[model samples]
Target: MVVSTRAGAERSQNITVVRQAPPMSRTVSAAGLGAVGGMVTEYLFDPELGRSRRARLRDKGVRLTHGVRNGTRTVVRDVRNRGQGVLGAARYRTTGREADDEVLHERVRAELGRHVRHPREVDVRVESGHVTLTGDVLDRESRRAHRAVARIPGVAGVDASWTTHHDARRAPRSREDGGPMEALQDLFRQRWSPAGRSLTGLAAAVVWSLSGRLPRPLGYLVRAGCAVLAARAATNLPLRRLTGIGAGRDAIDVGDSISVAAPAEEVWPVLSDYGLFARWMPDVLDVRRSDDGGRSQWRVSGPAGVPIRFEAVETAREEGRRIAWKTTEGQLVAHSGELSVTPEDAGRSRIQVRLTYNPAFGAVGHAVAKIFGADPGRKFAKDLMRLKSLIETRRAPVGAGAGPRE
Candidate 1:
C-alpha cells in the first residue's frame, strides 16, 4: 500500500504503506503540552490498539509523520529532531539491532506505496540533495507526511523545500486512507507461502518410501536407492561430466517456452529477468549471469545431504527469447537445450522446452528423473503453467524473484 497526498482535494483513505512496510513515526515539540495531550488522547482511541501509542507523539501539533507499527515506544534517536544537529541524540525507534535497519526503510517504502491516494504526483529517491519531494498534496495535512518520511529510521532530514502545487481528487483507493498517504497496501499481496504444500508433498514421499501404499514401492527405498545411485553417479567421471552437478557448468541448449491461455511473448518479461530463476527452478540455489558476458550459472542444491554447488551452465538471449546452454561441467554432463515460446491461442502461450542431457548412467539416470519426475518436473511444468496463469491474467509474480527451492 502507498500513502499519497494531493494539493487540495480531501477524500483519501488511511495511510498507504508499500513494498516493505516496517514502521511509522512522527515528531513533537517538547514544549507543547496541549499538542502532547491531544496525541495521548488519539492513541487511546485507535482501532488496532496495538499501535495506538504512536499517536502520543502528536503532542506538538502532534504529527504522525510515520504510520509504521514498531511496537509501542516513543524513541529519541533522530538527528534532524535533535534540536542540535549532530547524529543520533534525536528521536526514532530502536528495533534492538542495527542490522535490522533495512527493515525500517522497506517498511517506510511499503507504507508510502500502499497508501498513496489521488495525489498530483509522488516521487522518492536518495541523493546528495536534502532528499527532495516535489509533488502537490491535498492539504497542509500532508506536510507532516513529507516530514514523516524524512524522519524515517535512518533518514537525516527533509528538503520539503520543493514547492507544493494545489489540486486533489475526491475518492481514492480504499486501502490508502481516502487521502494521499495510501499507496503501498498491496504492493506484494501476491506472495504465497508454499511451506504447507511442500511439507505435505515431502510427507507423501516419506509415506510412499516407508510403507508400500499406492501402486508404487516404499518411498525410503526409492530415496535410498536414488541416493546411492546419485552417489555412484557423482563419483562416475562420465556422469560427472554429464549433469554438471558440482562444477560450475554452463547450461546448454536452453530452450524453454510458456504455453499459456494467451500467445507467445506474453511471458517475456518474467522470463527476461534471469534472476527470476530462483522462483521457478526447483532445488536450485542462485541463477546468475556473469558480469563479463551473457553467460549464466546455476548453483544447485546437490542431491540429498550434499552441500550446494554449481549444477549447470547456461546462456539466454532476447531477454530469454531464445535460451540455450551446455553443461560445461554436474549431475548431467554435456547438457543442452532449445527453449521456444510457441504462442497458443486463447491467450495461452505454448512453451516448448527441448532439453537433452548426456547421462552417463543412461537408463539408471532416466530412473532418477522418473522418481522425482512426476512432482518436481510437474512443478517445473507447473511453473510454466503458472507463468501462463500470471501472464494471461496479467497478475504479478508470486514472490521476490523466487521462493525457496523445493
Candidate 2:
C-alpha cells in the first residue's frame, strides 16, 4: 500500500521506496557530476532510483549516485546524462550523449572491428566530426593521437584524451589512417543526407506523385508552382495556403528548429550527415548522393516497387554544406533547388532550402497565385521532432563539454 501527503502540485508520498544502490551509482563520481552538471549531484541521499523510471518522468527524470574511480569524473558525468538532456540526472544533468557514445563505440567496434588491449601495438581512434583518426601511437599515446587528429582535414576537432592500449613500444605502423570501425561511422554520416536518392523524402514524393486531386503531366505543373511559392514564402512557416490550387507540383514549405546541448562545432558533424527531407516528405521516392563523382539522383517509386516517370538529377554539387539539383522533364514539371546551412547564434545553424519547381497547367503557362493549405504544415511539425532526436544524440568525449548547439 502507498500513501501520500499533497498540497497544490507538490506531493510527498509514503510508498515502498526500493532504497537499493543504482547500477551506475558506483561509477557516478562527484567530479563527473560536477563536470557535466556544474556542481550538482555530489550530495549523498537515500532512495536511489533506477533507469526503470523512464515511464514516470514527464518533462524530465533522473537517477544518480557517486563512487567513481580513475576517470571517475568522466564516468559519472556520462551517467548523470544517461538520456536526453530533458531526461534529467537526479542531481544534475546534460544529455547522456557522451555515455551513449561510449556504449555505441564498444558495441559496433570490430567485426565491425575496433581496438583491443595487447602487449605489442596500441591503436587510437578519435572521432570528432567528418574525420576519424585511426592510427597507432605508443602507450598512453592519447596526447600523440590528439596531435595527429588536429592535422587531419575535414575534421572539425578531436577530443585530446581519446586513445586505446597496446603492449609493444614499437609497432610496424597502422595499416592506413582509420580502420573499418571509423569507416562505418563516417559511412553512415554520408548516407544520412536529405538530398540523396533512396531517401524517405523521395519515397513520400513518389507516393504522393499519384495522390491528391490534380492529375500529373497537368497536375505536376500545379505542384511545381505551389512548391516554388511555398519555398519563397516563409523562414518560420505558417504555410496556410490562401486557396486550394489543384496539385501537380504544388509548392511545399517545411520549417524546423532543433536544440542540442553542445556548441555548433560539435553539432556540425551530425548536421553534416543529413540533407533536406523527412522520411515523410511526399512525392519523390528514392534519393541517393555520391561525391565520388558529380552525380546524384532522385528515383521515384510507384504502387509497388515499380519506378515512376519522375527522377531528379543534381546539376551542381559541393562536397560539404551545399547541393544544387535540377530536373528538366518539364513536360509535366521542372524541379530546381539548393540546400544551404548557415551557422546561427548559440552554437546552432539555420538550414535554408530554396526550391523552385514548375507545376504544369496555368492560365497562361506561368507560375501563379497561392492558397492556404494545412496538411503539409502538420507534417512539418513531425519532421522537426526527428531533427531534434538526431542532433541531440551526437556523441563527444566524456567530461569535456558537449559542443552541441543548445
Candidate 3:
C-alpha cells in the first residue's frame, strides 16, 4: 500500500511537470514577441529621424494599397476581355462566318509583325483572306513567317515570293529592325519600366501561389524564387543591379563633391597621383602604383587595425579633367571610382568623386559597415575635405595619419 501511494505521488509530480511546460514556453514566446515589438518601436520612433521615418512608412503603405487595388482591377479586366474573345470565337465558329477582307489583311499583317524578325523588310498584302509575303527575308524566318500568317484566324492562303539570305549580316534590312513585341521586351529588360513591373508583379503572384502547393526542398526553392520575383516587381530593378553585381553609371553607390581654393590644373596633379592619396585620404595607409602606371595596389586601415587591400586599374584618364578606375577581377569586393575636376571662378575648382562598390554580403555588409563608421561614402567626404585643406595650405591637414581620421 505504501508503494502504491508512492507511485500515485510520482504520477501527480509528472502531471505537474507536464502542466508547467506550456506556461514556460508561453512565457518565452511572449518575451520574444515583446523584444521584437520594442525594437520595432525604437526603430520607428528614434529621437532624430522618427517623424520622417513614420511618414515614409505611411506613404509606402498607401502606395502598396493602391498598387494592390489597381493590379486586381487590371487582372479582372484582362480576364473579362479574354472571356469575351472566347465567346466571340465560339459564335464565329458556330455561324461559319468569316471576317471582312480588310480585317483579314490587318490580321495577317499583325501576324507577320509578330513572327518576322525584320518585319519592315517583309511587305505583307492580303486580299480576299489570302496573304502574299514579298521582299527581302531571311531564310530562317521565311518558313516561320509563312506558317504564322497562314494560321491567322481569317487567312485563307499564303503566297511566299522572294529573296532570302542565309546570313543576317548580308541581309538588306538592318539588324535593328524588330517587331513591336521585341521592342516591348527590350524595354521590359530595363531597370524600371511600367510593363516590366506589371509582368513581374503578375509572375510573382503566380509563383507565390505555386510555392504553397509544392513539396519540401522544392517548395523552399520556389519560396525563394517568389521572394526574388516580389522584390523585382516592387523595386523594378534587374537582378544584377539589385544584388550589386557590376558597376555602371546607374550603380553609383556613393558620391560627393567639394570646392577647393586651388585651380583645376593644380588640383589635378595631386588627385591624379596615386602615391599622394595616402597622405590626404583618410585611413589609406599605402598605395603602390604599377610600373606601367595603369594599375595600383591600395591598403586601407580597417577596424581594429585590420588592413583592407585591393588592386585597381585605371580605365580612363583625361588630363586635368577626369580619371576613372575599377577593381581587378576576382577581388573580394568589386568597386569602381571616377573623379572629375571642373574649374570655377577665382582659381577655385569643383572636384567630384563617384564610387560604386559591391562588397561581401551585398547590402547587408554595406549597412553593417555604415554602422561601424566604415562606410566609404563617409570616408570619401572626409578625405575630400582634407584634400581641399591640404591643397589650399600646401601642408598635411592636422590629425592626418596612417589610421582613420576622427
Candidate 4:
C-alpha cells in the first residue's frame, strides 16, 4: 500500500510522475503522466511559458503543472508574459490522438488526388492525425500538394519536408495533362464547324474588300492583319461540341456573354471568388479551388437537389485576358470551357463564357436536349445576365473580405 501526503494520508495511492531528460526538453513537449484511476494520462509542461506558448497549449487542451526535469525546477505562474511577437517559432508537440487510421489515410489520399495530377505515384502515411506526404512532384506541384492537404478538416498537420522535385523526364504531368500542340489541334478542330466556316468566309470577304481599295503594300499589310485577327477570333469563339459522351452526338454546347460596368480588374475578383460563386451562379452549390489557383472541384445541386460533383483544372490563363479550364475527373460531368474578359472602354468590360458539357443520360437526355433546344444558349444567357446584374449594381453575395461597396 502507498500512503499519500497531507490530509489524504490514510488512503492508498498509485501515482507515477515520469520526467523526461533535460537535453530533450528545449521546446514544449507533451508526455504521458500514466493513468492513476481518474487522473489525466498526459501532462504537458515547459519552463518558459510565453503568451504564444500558453495560447497554443490552451487552445490544444494543455494545462500547467509544477514540475522539474533533470533536477531543474520549473515555475508555475500565470501565462500572461508579454512583449513577444505572435509569429514566434513556437511549435506544439504532442502524442497523436485516437483516430481511425484507415479513414485518415483514405481522406489524405482523396484530398491529394483532387489537387495533385498524379496521386497514384505519391506516397501518403497517416499516424493518428499527423500526415506525411513524401514523393517526387513536378515543380510547384509539391507546394500545392502541401497547401491542399493542410486545408483538410481532420488533418492536424502535414510534414512535407521529405517531398522532393522530380527530374523533367520523370516529372508528373500537371493538372493540364495534354501537350500544347494537342490542345491547339483540339481547339482548331472544334472550331471547324459549318457555322465557324461561314463566319471565317464572311471575315475573309470583308478583309479582301477593304484591302483591294488600299495601295499595293498597304493591301498586303491589311491582309496579314486580317489573318491574325481571324486566328484570334477562331480561338475566342467557344462553340465546340465533342461527339460521344453526355447526350452522345447531341451534346449541349453553351455560350453566353455579358457586359459589366466595372473593368476586368474589379470584375475578375468576383469571378475568381470560388467560395461565394454558388450564391450568384445558377445551380451551383459550392466550388473549392486548390492551391496555385490552377485547379478546382465544384459541387452542384442537381435534379431533386441531389449533389453532383466534378473536378476541373485550368489549362491556360492570361491575366485580365482569358482563362480556360477542362474537366480532369469526367466521371460525372465531362466538360471544357473558357472565360474571356475584353476591355470595352476605359471603365467597362465584356465577359463571355463558352462551355461545352455532356449531359450523358443518353436517351432521356437526348429528348430533354431537343426540348431545351440544340444548345444551352438561353440558360447560359440567363446565368451571365445574373452576373452582369450583380457586378454592375455592386451587389455580389457575402464572401470573405467582401463588404459594402464604395
Best candidate according to TM-score: 3
Q: How close is candidate 4 to the true structure, as a TM-score?
A: 0.36
- Cα lDDT tens digits, model 1, 248-311, are 3321222345546654565666655556555555445577778865566666555553545443
Output the number of the lDDT-best candidate: 3
- Would you estimate the TM-scores of all the predictions? 0.32, 0.28, 0.63, 0.36
RMSD of each: 33.8, 30.7, 7.3, 34.9
Error of 3 at 93 (Å): 19
Query: Candidate 1: which stretches are off by over 4 Å?
Result: 1-258, 305-307, 311-320, 329-334, 344-348, 358-360, 368-377, 393-406
Checking candidate 3 for backbone clashes, the offending pairs are: none
C-alpha positional error of residue 224 in candidate 2 after TM-score superposition, expressed in Å: 24
lDDT of 2 by residue, 182-204 (tens): 33431134222222221333444
| Model 4 regions lying over 4 Å from their true place | 1-250, 361-367, 370-375, 397-406
Per-residue error at 82 for model 4, in Å? 90
Clashes of each: 140, 66, 0, 1
How well does candidate 2 match the true structure in TM-score terms? 0.28
Model 4, 77-96: lDDT tens per residue? 11112113222312211222
Q: 1 or 4, which is superior by lDDT?
A: 4
> lDDT values of the candidates?
0.48, 0.41, 0.77, 0.61
Ranked by lDDT, the better of candidates 3 and 4 is: 3
- Give the Cα-based TM-score of candidate 1 against the true structure: 0.32
